[model samples]
Target: MKNILHVFRHDLRRATSNVMAVIVLFGLVVIPSLFTWFNVIASWNPFENTKNLTVAVANTDEGYQSDLVPIRLNVGEQVLSALRANNDLNWVITSEDEAIDGTKSGEYYAAIVLPPTFSADMMTFYSNGSEHTKIEYYTNEKKNALAPKITEQGAGEVSTSINEVFTEKLSEVALNIITSLSGYLDDADTQATLSRLQARVSGVAAQLRAASTTADMFTSLIASSRPLVDSASGLVSTSGDALQDATGALGTGKDAAQSLKDVLTSTTVALGDARSGTADSYQAVADSVDDVFSSMNAQSASSADALGAAATRVQTQIDQHQQLRDTLVNDVRPLLPESAVDSFDRAVSRIDASIARQQDLHDRLDHAATHITDTDADVQAMHAEITGLIANAKASVDDAQSAYTGSLQPKLDALAETLSVIGGDVDSIGSDLSSVAESLSGSDSLTTALEHAESLTTDISSTLTETADRFDALANALTKAMDTGDLSELTEVIGADPQALATHLAEPVSLKRVPVYSVVSFGAAMTPLYTVLALWVGALLISVSIRVDPPQGAASDLPVLTPTQTYLGRFGIFALVGFLQSSLVCLGSVLFTQVQPEHPFLLILTGWVMSLVFTLIVYTFVVTFGNAGKALAVLMLVVQISTSGGAYPLQVLPQWFQNISPFLPATHAVNAMRSAIAGIYQNDFWVSLGLLAAFALPALLLGLVLRLPLIGFNQKLLRALASTKLM
Candidate 1:
């Protein structure tokens, strides 16, 4: 210990006694500090100002003039304007050829060329759906890693902005149209239009009534002609045969009418049955969906209940832990010896903090779960209501079909029976006339009767012809008015529930976003990890040049110094230099950048501690292994770069890296710094600090204590330096 102290005092005096040596000593601290500071500063938030990197934009897009919209769509122009406004990229307006050539010549980081049909393809969104418009993003990887990456990011940003603007504008237009339509549907003009249609339908019904009246008049004429035909049969027996043939035709007509009536009745019944079945099926589906919803509700409730119970248990455990911690801290700690009290209180505090962290996580989990179940319940209730609406519609259809069948079927049956009776009367009259014609074949009034019968038949046939004409005119008029009825019903339905109709037509499904945490920006998220890596690398870089062994210019008449004295004396200087370098870098970042660490003092203190720890470990390697240690330190830097979880998460890496990460000083440094920066010192914060202390203390001890015993290994350092001639 005395020799180590002697060497330290001797070295400090040698360096300070001479003016040149003093200048060199000051240079050692200032040079590394400046090197770390300026280099880190140059790269700090490098992407923050990407305005210098040029990206050529060639927009050869034509505007699409849509008939549906008043304005022409020029998405390319909008994108170009947005690019100009945005500071993320230096967007240069140029031709395609120029853009391509510039990217090839490294004048631009990337080139984006829009096709001529960009707006035309985008306009198709209203007609069909989203159509992808290709904006050619040409990147030159040879420009360097970052430039290509940044340019691609810029291109992606432009694409997203274009999509957002187009979607927003389209939504606005559609919503405006819907709003206007809703007002128009509610206006008095809509009711007038519907009333006109209903009046037209009423006029059509009147035509049907006229057709029926004509048919009834024709039936009366048929009954009246039965007597005339009967009277003439006796006068002209052969003409009576013609009457018979007419009566048979009537029979055929009656059969056809009966068949039509039966068909109508059966069809009505079938439709009613179909409606009933559809209603039943719809009900079944609703029931099934409801059952599943109930099951989901039950499951969610069970999960929430379990989580709540678990929360209660965790709270109980926390209460118990709090009681113990409070007892140990306030009551028992004071009674314990001074040495035991500090450690006991620290242990109790760590346990209490860990418990609190666990409790917070559990409570949040339970709360989120509870909210999830509640939302699910609400969604399920909405689904049930929608199902009920569908069921009610089905029931309405069933009732309509049933009512129509009940009222119209019997009327058709009665009409068919009336036609059958008319046919029977014609047949019976023809039969009676046949008997009378044979009996009265020689009567004197035969010619007069035959003429009268012929005249009556002619008049009856004319009446039938007029009846057919009337039916034809009525059918055509009814056909025209039926269209008006359909239109009226449609208008009425839309006018009644335009809001629901519009909502359903616009978006059948919706996306609900539930945010859990505020998204942190890239700069804020990466600051802590990068600071840790930079501090460690900065320590490694400068420590290599600072020698840990006694200088050849030291007093030669003194006793030879052991390796412990050499290692300690050299480490004191390295530690001081490393501390200055790391502290300057951190302070510079804090002063210059927008780094707002939660615990500002803790950030500086942790950084300084990390510097001391890293300096000791690195100082050990340099002193014990000499130039071989420098190679090892460089190798360590490479390894730590990958395994440190500085950029990517450790779990995402290979298993070997994850297994080794917990032991690495960089890991703990980054973890502690992140907690300090984010103001979230969870259970891992103190553990990382402890690990850092554990690494630093043991390393420092081993470097000084083991340096004497490992003299053989120290001698090999000289051999490695001489034989390999390595630096």
Candidate 2:
């Protein structure tokens, strides 16, 4: 430890005592400071001078005229007028050819040219399938790296200004139209016309009210008739059922008529036979009576007349039954299915044949009575034949009576009951239909009320049409009257402050930027990086100018120093120079330039620590490996400069650079200084300082522990370089 102190003091004295050494030491201190100060002053406020970047402007608009607007619009001229007042960039007005040539030849940073159809396109806002108004922007990107970016921002400003102007103009036109409309509304003539229109509309409304009243009456009529309609439908259905029953009854009556016809037919045939047999008997009996009673011939004549009269009565009975059957068949025939018509007709024919047979029998009986004047021989035979004939006629009459009572009479009674039911249903249906028809024809029926409502509605529609036409004519008259007055009076009537409104509409939103840990200028914000670079470069200058090892003779007066002692003693001199360099660079930043740090002491302390760490690293490498170590130090500086997040953020660097950035000493130094300059957040300043100080440990190991073992090899390397006759 004594040896280390002795060597450190001895080297310090030698470096200060000589004039050349003091001058060289002074130069070393100022060199690193100059590097940082020059850069800081150069970049103090770069964007403030961007107005000097030239951008060419060319206007080629032909202007547009609108028939409805009564004005000629030239958007290109408006843009040029706006650019003249803007100082964000240097706007040079020229022809299109000149602008393009200037931009290409690097005389201008960028060029903006309006097309010939620019104003016409702007006026096509309400037109279909229109092209957008375009301002062609051309940039000479090769002019300067940042010139294009600045000029691009200028082009964006130009676009924004154009939008504001266009919006302000549209708002003005709309406000003027609204002002005219307000004047029209205030006109007394227009108000009178509107009053008349309102009166007409009221009349239409009265008509609608009358129509609504009629509609209500119609609705009530419909509601009342619903039950009647249902009853009528039921009555019609019942009538159909009853008619069906009547048809069945007709079928029954037809069968009864058929049975009666059959009985009459059998009775007729039986009577015919009885008459033929009794005719012979009557002739013989008449002859016998004539012979036996010559003196009583008058009695025989009376009996013969009696026999003829009885035969005539039987014929009258047969004709009456035939006529009744014929009437029943004819009535039932129309009601029966078409298929039963032929059968009913045949029954009628059979009844006619039966009547004919009865008529012939009557004729035969009358002829037999008239021929009874002839004499006969047998009286007993005549009496027996007469008795047999009476018995057969009586039996035929009794059989017919039984058939009529059992089959025909009961069927006829059923048919009458069915017909009575049908008559009652038909009467009910007729009553229902009469009631419906009366309701329909009545004054307050649904159909009548609907017709009245329709009439009222048609009148209301016509009245509304006439009112609309009057309103249109009134509006046209009011427009012409208002147009005859001075248009400027409209704006006065509207009572609007156009200047205030236009200003608000043009730039409605004002941005208030609230900066966090705000930096005053570009150079001040860049102080951390430049300060860090100065510290490392200061260490490099020290390494190159001063030796890393103690002089062999000067250190001999002290006891033989161990490698650790030797390494510390030599590092003490380098560390002092690094401290001096860091102080001048950090203090000069705020003192000489415009850099104002939140914690000036912390900023200086960060620089001091970073300089020490950087010096130890370079000194260790040089001490351990001789000249090769200096080259290694230079390479390390290059890597740290690129990856240290100095000029640009570490995030913006390549992946490899970012990956190695955390391990570099400059990375932590820049971070710590930024915290101090920008106002510390959390423990960032302390943490970054701690990381930067950590580099000293590994540097101490390389110089003290590792340098001892490589001393021989390092000496050989130095000797070999010397032998090459170059360094």
Candidate 3:
């Protein structure tokens, strides 16, 4: 360890005396630091000046009347005033051309231009949907970035304020127009007209209700009348049946009477012959004939009387049936509609025709029986007269029979037929009544549904009327409020109302940032490269100086120590000196420039390690090859310096340079030092330290192995010098 210290002190003294080392330290340390200081100054505060912004506008608008007032508000002036009033902005108003030039020269960051017809165009757009009005913003590309952005934000705020104001004013004018129109409608005539219309609608509603009720009542009455018609038809049928039975009884009695009359006439004629001796019979025949005649006469008289009574009863029944028919035709038929009455009349007429036909048939029967009366005329003149009287009675019976059978019986039969037809008609009428009842029920249901619908409609109408009334009240209030026209109180709510001239001053624009610091400058970036190169060159020179002399006595004539002693001595001295030099430079940089050391100890250690590796490599060449090794050291330094990324980041360097960079000790040292300065070192610092150690160790071991030959050369040179001294 004492020997190592001796060698360490000796190499350090040698490095201090080397001219190349002095030059390397000055160039690498001093020059690079000055450049870094200049870089920091150039890139200063870029956003500070953006707070005081300026905008310019030009407007040549001709104002027009709005809502019967002359609109003399200059839009451009109003916009400029609003922007100027804002605390964040310092707006400078100017002509369009001048503003553009000022922005381009960076005097103003942004400028606004208001077109000449801005007011007229905006009004036209509102009234007629025109597209003539436009706002334009101009921004300088060379201005600071914050300046243009602030100007754009200010313009947007101004536009929003103007829109609120304009909309409020327009609403006021519209309300005034509505108020004037409403005043015209407040007269009495219109009110009276409306009242009359209401009354007419009410009348129509009442009439519709009455019509509905009447239709329902009519349908009910028709339904109730159907059963009565059915009952009347049943009564007519019963009457026809009774009349048919009476007529049948009367016919039976008339037939029996005719038979008895024939028998009586035959018996009387036999008695007459017996009594006139035209018979061959004795007193018994005459007496029998007399008795038979008398019995036959009595039976005939009784049969005739019975037949007359039957005929009379039949006539009475017929009279009752006729009376019922007449009553039906007169009373019930009149109550029916014309069509029903016509049907009843037709039925009655059919009955009458059938009666006339029966009467003709009865007359033919009466005529046939008249000859029997003529044959019995002269048996007893008084009896003949009686027979004549019976014949007359028979004729009367015939007449009565004819009346009953022909007229009455036929009328009854016809009435029965008519009643059957009427019953059918009644059945049809009942079906019609049923249909009418169903239709009436459906109509009732429909009316109920309609009533519900009408109630809903009335509710809807009432709601509509209420809404319209509320709307009219709202409109009146709004109209009255607008007529006041004092919108100063609304200014807080509506904000700034920009004139038509300033409408064109609202828009957004972009600005390109001009760099305050030249970050891409060549000199600022190259300082680190030169610093790394000088350090590597200085380390190589120190390594060469220590390897210049051999050991005190050795066979070889080389002027360096053995390789092992030479490498250890030089590397030890270089490590200490490099550490001192790195500490001094970093201290100077921090004190003078803004450059800070992220890891002070690591940076110092990296410098020491790099110096040791450089010293070992230089010792290996010089100890192995004597004076010729100096040229080899220079070549190695140049190669390592060129490959090291301290000059530029490794990414920007050629692919081959990056590949060989880790092999060089200077490359590792620079990377480690930069990491310490930048405060970003992690894997890079550790990896670089390991690589430098690898190079330093291997070089030191190789120097140690070649030291034997160097020591022998040193002994030989010392002995030769001794022999020269003895001679």
Candidate 4:
């Protein structure tokens, strides 16, 4: 301990004895502090001056014509307007090509471009399903790394401003809509109009329902008529066959009459034989007539029945048409405007015409059926008359032989005339049957009318369904609105100032940040790192410029010092110099810079302790290993700068650096200073200060124990450096 004090005092006296030595010592003390002051000042408020970083803004947007609002929209222009008012960055308005070129050429930090379709694309927000608009951002990442980050922040600010603007505009539109609706609700005339509209809608709905029912009935009528139509078709076929058979029978009867006439008029035949043959021929004609009549009777009965069923079906269809026409006229027409009434009237006329045609077909079918019944009765009467004529002819056969030229010939002629008349009547009946068949076959008008009615029914049903869905949606929306509040309350809310509401809606939430241990400026927050770094550098400078070893002859009179005592003695001088350096840096930071540490005295004390520790560590390296030790100190300084977490956090460093950070003296030094500069946690300051002081122990061991073996090697290395003649 005595020898340690002796070496410390001896070095101090030698340094102050000469003016040159004192000047050198003064340089050493002030130089390291200058490094800290200048660095702190340079980075004091770097972010505050970011307004000098040039960023290009290019607007190439075409205006968009919006149907929602009367005004044309240009989102690019609005964005540019917002940016022009912003002072966060140096904004330069230019063309797209120029902005792109400037960004690529390093003339600008970044460029934001609004393309020609920017405004048009923004209008797509009102569309149903459209992609969002894009604002092209170009950045030169090769520029200063920090500058690019600041420019990116500027871009984000622009995006946020645009969002605010969009929100404000949308709020204004919504407010306007609400105000308009409120005004409408407040007006008496509007209320009346609304009531009338509701009534008209209700009426239309009812009319639709009635029309739908009528359509259903018409469709049912068509469906039910299918069987009747088939039956009518069968009747037509049967009637045609019956008519053919009657015609053939008439021709056969006519031929028999001709044969009888020829037999009666013959010269070579006997009277009795002619009479018998005439009787047989007449009987044969009667039998054929009777067969034809029976067939006609059956066919006519079936035809009449089929015609009656078809007429009944036609009547039902006509009734449905009349009901539909009534709905169109009474319920639907009054709701229609005059211009539409003509069209409605025309439609009704068409329906009436259809009904008339259907009725005509019904009447024709009825008339044909009546004619068939009358013809059937006439055929039965004719058959009875023919049977009587055959009986009289058989009884007159014997008498007819006596009066051959007189009574027999005349009677034969009369019977032949009767047969001819019956043939004509049969021909007339055949013509009536043909007419019925033609009428039944030509019933395409009825089919066409049924098809039209079915189509109309489908259209009405679809329209009714759609209307019902729309009404349901409207009811749901109104119900939800009423659930929140009544319409009167909504109107009252809308009565407030719209602009204030719009502004509130635009920015509904705000962030309130309460900083936890706030430092005033960048330089103030960074003071701990730079001040600590300067202390290390100051220790390094002392190791290089001043000698760590006491002079060999000056300490010769003292007791021979042990290596531990020598090491402690030399570190005492370094420690004094380091304390002066730390005091100067700490005072400069507190007095001259923006740094205002919470515990200013503690900051100075921490600095002093760190300086002592750092000085001892560097001094040990140099005194133990000669010039190579100085190189090792410089290398350590470099490593500490990177790993100490002074400039950045330890977590941000590489894994190896973070692992070694806790062991580094500068790391602990910076931590202790930070605790003093900001608000100290429980034992953070003491812990850091103790960790930093602990580094001095290993340094002492290297100097006291490790150097004992390297003393010869270090001496030879010094000799070799001296041999170069540079020092």
Candidate 5:
């Protein structure tokens, strides 16, 4: 261990004297120090407390003509005014050419140019619906970073202002158009046109009203005529009933007369037979005459009974007619006019009187017929007795027959003529009923015609009412159209101009002035890592210098030191020297550059840890492959520097490069250091520390293992001599 320390001290002293080693150390310390300074300067707040930002504007738009005003403000002027009014910025208006030159030369950060036909194009956009006359901004891209961004924002603001003005103007124009339309509609000519329309509507309405009124009158007339029609219809029905009743009575009378005629004929035939049989057998004739008289009497009695029944039926008919007459006068008559009622009453009375007369005639006829039948029966019996008595005296029988035939035949013929006259009277009454029925039928036809006319009138009234309702709707629609007055007003209430409205509400933009600052050049962020790399290269050179020296004399055969002490001595000396080099670099940055670290102690500590890790790595490789290990260290340095995203973020590198970036110690160191400098708190600092520890601890242990055989006094002198030539 004593010899190893002695060898370590000898190697360190020789390393300090070598020109290449000193030069390598200086390059490592100075180059990274400058890079770190530049990075710190680049990251400083350039825009802090920046004020009075200058902005450029160019407006070339011509004024517009309005109906009420000769000239109106152009869109460009409106944009300019809006920018000037903004409290966030100070706007400077310049000609288009001047603004452009000033922006490019960094005199002005941003420039805006309003198109030549801005107002005219906008009007054309409104009138012809074209998209033209876009607002444009010119900005200096390289001067200050914020300048272009501010210019972009400013151009947006100007566009917004122009849109707002255009929108407001358009709204005013719409309102004015509405007002103009209202005036035009209220003028005499338009009002006259409306009046003509109203007159036409009113005329149609009047016609409808008249038709309605006429319908009402027709309905009233129908109401008034209904009673008369009803009465006529009732009279027709009643007359028909009366005629049917009279026809039925006539049928009954005819049937009874025919039966009575048959009975009378049968009686006459029996009487004649009895009279003829008396001469053939006087006694037998007398008996047959008695039978004949009995038969004749029965038949005559039946005929008389039939005549009585006919008379009673006629009497009943007369009573029914009288009742009908009374009912017509008391109940049905008042329902008709006085003349018609009286006429019906008279007809009923006449029918009743006729029925009474017929009844009397039938009664007289029946009584006379009954008397004649009884007389005939007596004569038949007497004739029969006389014929029997005369048959005994045969010469007087013919004379008796002549006397009986002459008297009975004349009375029977007179009865037959009376029955025929009564039947004729029944026929005449039936004819009268038929005439009344025909008159009632004619009245019914007239009543039906009146009902048809009433229905037609109702249909006409309904049609007229529908017409009036349609006219009312037309008038209301016309009134609403007149009240609205303007098409533009309708368009606005209905979301007609969506794009213009959207443009109007957007935020106004102005040119943004970016404060100028010194920018760090490319690859400046990786300066500290590069410096650490240069330090490792310088350490390798020193290690080679110590190893290549010639051996001293026959060395003491002291046992080799343990791998731990031998590796520790090499690792410790390099670690301390690398740390001293990193400290010098950080000190140079603070002194020469205006780089102020937020946490100076932590920054220094991080640098020290990085140096130790690099030292262990250099020692491990050097012990493993001797002088050839220097080439591996250089390769590692290249990989670390390339992978570390210091100058450009790792994201900007190719994908494969980004994949291997975490394994590079330089990458971890750069990220951790940037986090500290930028006040970006992150867990990556500890992680980076751990990764560096892994590299440093393992390299130190491995170097110890590899150096175990060379730990003795003589072996250390020989290893030092070998390291010197390799440097």
Candidate 6:
């Protein structure tokens, strides 16, 4: 440590003793301050002076109007107004061609263009809800990157302002349309519908009043039909009873037919007996024919006359029976059902056969009588003929009896069966009619209910007719209202104040800027870079005039100081000059004068550390290689200034620069100072401070650790250069 102090004081005395060295040291103080304050004052806050940068604007929007919406849209004019009002960007309005050329020529950072169809596209959106109007934005990337970026942001703001105004105007139009619809639909507007509506109400009332009257009328009509239906039911009942009586009468008729059959049977038997007697008498007469002829000779004519009369009488009786049979057939046959008519015919046929046989006998008698009369004239003339005639009559009588017995009883049985069937059918009919009558009697309530239903139908029909009239009135009323354009009240509901609406739409959001690291101005925010550069460059100047180590030819013969002592002594001298440079730059660069740092003491501390580390780096390099080493130190200063994150963030630099940014001492120095000035202690703050401190280690190690070899190599090179007369 004493050796280091001894060398440090000796070098300090030597520097002051030389007038040129003293002047160089004084220049060091002035130069670093000049580097920091002069540049900082020149480009202090570029963004705040952006009004100097011109951005071209071209608006060729042909204004459009829509008849469907009674409004004209002039969006380009609105944008111009907004642009003129805004001071954020210097917008130069020009023709499309000029704006395009200006942007291409780099005269403007960016250009904004409104197409000729801008308002037409907007009109299309309002007319049929289609299409979007696009604002053209052209940027010059060929220009510096920051100006174009800032100009693009300004262009976006212009578009947003115009769109807000467009939306506000469009909403007003839509609101008015809705209001017009409301007015058109207002129903209270005077119309013919009022009278029609009243008429409909009157018709409905009239129908309601007639409902009971129509019902009662139906009741009366139904009541009148009940008696006629009852009469029909009664008539059917009487017909059934009459059929029953007719059935009883037919039973009596059957009994009478049986009686007649029996009587006919008895008569037939009598006729048989008479036929036998006649046959016997005829035989007797033949035997006594001679004797009888003599006895009847005198009365023969009278006898003939009597026989003729008997024959006539028999003929007359047969005619009477036939007439009676005809009367019975024509009258009584019709009285029975057709099934019994055949029985009546069979009975009458039997009677006709019997009577026919009787007629034959009578004819025979007449002939015999005539013969007798003739025989009187000629005695014993026709006795045999008369006998033969008598025999024939008897035979006929027997045949008549046979015919009556054969057919009459069978016919009577048939007539009896027919009468029995007729009687049963009549009884069944009577029973059925009685049942029908009872059913009709039980249906009295059904008739009343049916009558009520008919009454209701008439009432409903009347109601429907009245309702139809009402509906007609309603339809007429609706048509009248529509023709007059009357509907409801909504016109005043959806209205807006234009100014208020525009204000609301214009800037819907506001920005509240809260800086984590507060800097008074953009210039102040960048103070760390200037101060750090000044500190580092001060170190390079200190190495120039001051001999960093002993001359190589003389270094071998000098007092035996250790390599670390040699390094510390030289670094100590550079440190004095570096700190002195830091003080002047920090004071002049607005470290506390133009801008108040959050940590003024820490900023001074940062500057001091940066100077110390930078001086060590240069001092070690110059000591190791003499004049060549000084050249290397200046080269390092150039590399660090370009690659360091002090001027621009390392992130924005080329990748190769970023790869080495962390290793640069100036990068760490600037970061540390930035933390101090801005009052933001980010991790980079401590990391950068630690890195700056760490850089001191390598400078120290090279100055002390490999010091013997480096000094030997530097001395040898120095001698070689001196020998060539280059020093």
TM-score of each: 0.48, 0.58, 0.32, 0.57, 0.38, 0.53
In candidate 1, what are the lDDT values of residues 285-321, reduced to their tens digit? 4454455445646676665454455445445544644
Number of the top lDDT candidate: 4
TM-score of 4: 0.57
Stretches off by above 4 angstroms in model 3 are 1-531, 541-547, 554-561, 570-576, 619-644, 647-649, 680-684, 705-727
Candidate 4 local lDDT, 565-589, one digit each (tens): 7778878778888999989888888
List the pairs of residues colliding in candidate 6. Answer: 185-487, 185-488, 186-487, 186-488, 187-487
Question: Predictions ranked by TM-score, top down?
Answer: 2, 4, 6, 1, 5, 3
- Can you tell me which runs of candidate 1 are displaced by over 4 Å? 65-74, 81-84, 126-131, 168-547, 551-570, 582-594, 648-656, 697-709, 716-727
Instruction: Estimate the overall C-alpha local distance difference test score of candidate 3.
Output: 0.51
How large an RMSD does model 3 have? 29.4
Candidate 5 lDDT score at position 363: 52
Model 4 steric clash pairs: none
**Quick one: best TM-score, which candidate?**
2
lDDT of each: 0.64, 0.72, 0.51, 0.73, 0.59, 0.68
Sliding window of 10 residues with minimal summed lDDT for model 2: 288-297
Residue range 39-119, candidate 6, lDDT tens digits: 677666777877877998899998888874557777788778778887887889998999989999988888889999987
Tell me how many clashing residue pairs each candidate has: 1, 0, 28, 0, 22, 5
The predicted structure with the larger lDDT, 3 or 5, is 5
Candidate 4 residues lying further than 4 Å off, grouped into runs, are: 126-129, 177-492, 495-497, 554-560
What's model 6's overall lDDT?
A: 0.68
Alpha carbon lDDT at 539, candidate 6: 77
Stronger candidate by lDDT (4 vs 5): 4
